[model samples]
Target: MYTSFFLLSSRWSLPMMMSISHRGTGVAMSLGVSLFGLSALVLPGHFADYLDLIRSLSLGPVLIYSAKFALAFPLSFHTWNGIRHLAWDMGKGFKIPQVYQSGVLVLVLTVLSSVGIAAM
Candidate 1:
């Protein structure tokens, strides 16, 4: 019926995947931030209490760092890809080569930025 769509790795190009990911990350972050804010408002204690509960878990350093990276990843990716989209909006980087280059650049920067933020 062709009512559904999928992104097969070999079928979709880099820019196509990045565009899809950008939209997905944007929606995810928006929903996540909204829920977090709502939760904070509805929950009993202050934000520090929530932070204390998590810290008291004593999750090892590796796990803590991994969790930080997981939290940072979407924000990093969306920010870099949003910049790429802005460039596109300006009628720049429309060439196929430039598109691929920017896509790769965005991914690299996302990972690097995420890791850097996570390290802190």
Candidate 2:
């Protein structure tokens, strides 16, 4: 029996994936920035104090890496997505093929940017 659910589809269509990534990154970036600002304002002591607190934990390598990823991912995604949006604003990449290509470009740029930020 043929049905809508039986149809094969591009499971990872470029536009679909990019749209979700855009929202995810936007929310993540907002939360990250807000939390960072809040921590600076609400923490009992200065930035060094928070650093000492984290340092005291003696976190394992995995934990450190996860923290780095969490911090880097949103910033990278938002930056890339913002660029994509700017292109749209300039009346570029409106076609489906160009949109998909640009999405790939955005992902690549985001990964590179994130890696660079994490390495810093």
Candidate 3:
């Protein structure tokens, strides 16, 4: 008699991937905010000093826009996922299909919101 206990490793399904991404992004965004808060408290200079420093760099518009997008992307993803969590907390959208659908929707919303914020 032969016995096999090994299980084949396979790629994760969409829902699993989404769930992991959501958690990862949430942790990253929380850390980002915490770091910002800590820096604000520890830094001696005022906010205007930093603002002026950046302004004086003379970087082109494309670089400025890219930086804006980088900053906004995490914020938008966190906001969208937070909404998803809120919906679940209210006992809504618990279905698997809804979860997957909302995952995709959140991503789209994140991209749109990030773009809009970066544009400003």
Candidate 4:
């Protein structure tokens, strides 16, 4: 059963994959925000001090850009996918073709918005 499930997952349709990804990204974003909040409450110094500490590290451009993209991609993906889920709640976009189209659209928008925001 496990093997069959794995095989099916490996060949998952677009909607299936997107649904899984949406849940995964939601969990990731929740964890990220929770950790940030916890750190804010527990850490000694102010947020500015941490910002200064990061700046003091003198991270390279590539590393900085990668970090920004990392932060941006999940946010973008989650937000767009959320709108898709909302449409589902409204009894819309249930058709197979519409599902695939919206899934592709979400991916495109996610990449575009993530890159745009990360570039800022």
Per residue, candidate 4 scores C-alpha lDDT tens digits across 1-93 of 999889977866888888898899989999999999999999998999999999999999889988999999999998999999999999999
Query: Candidate 1 residues 54-119, lDDT tens each?
Result: 989989999999999999999999999999989999999999999999999999999999999999
Candidate 2: residue 84 lDDT (0-100): 90
Question: What stretches of model 4 exceed 4 Å from their correct place?
Answer: 1-10
How accurate locally is residue 84 in candidate 4, as Cα lDDT from 0 to 100? Answer: 91
Please give me the total number of clashing residue pairs in predicted model 1: 0
lDDT per residue for candidate 3 within 1-120, as digits (tens), equals: 123332334556776776787788778978988999999999999989999999999999999999999989987887898888899999999998998899899989999999999999
Of candidate 4, the 10-residue stretch with the lowest lDDT total is 8-17
The residue ranges of model 1 lying beyond 4 angstroms of the native Cα positions read 1-10
lDDT of 2 by residue, 23-107 (tens): 8878877887899998888878789977898999999977887778778877788788888999999999899889988888888
Better of 1 and 2 by TM-score: 1
TM-score of each: 0.89, 0.77, 0.78, 0.87
Best by TM-score: 1
Candidates 1 and 2 compared by lDDT, better number = 1
TM-score of 4: 0.87
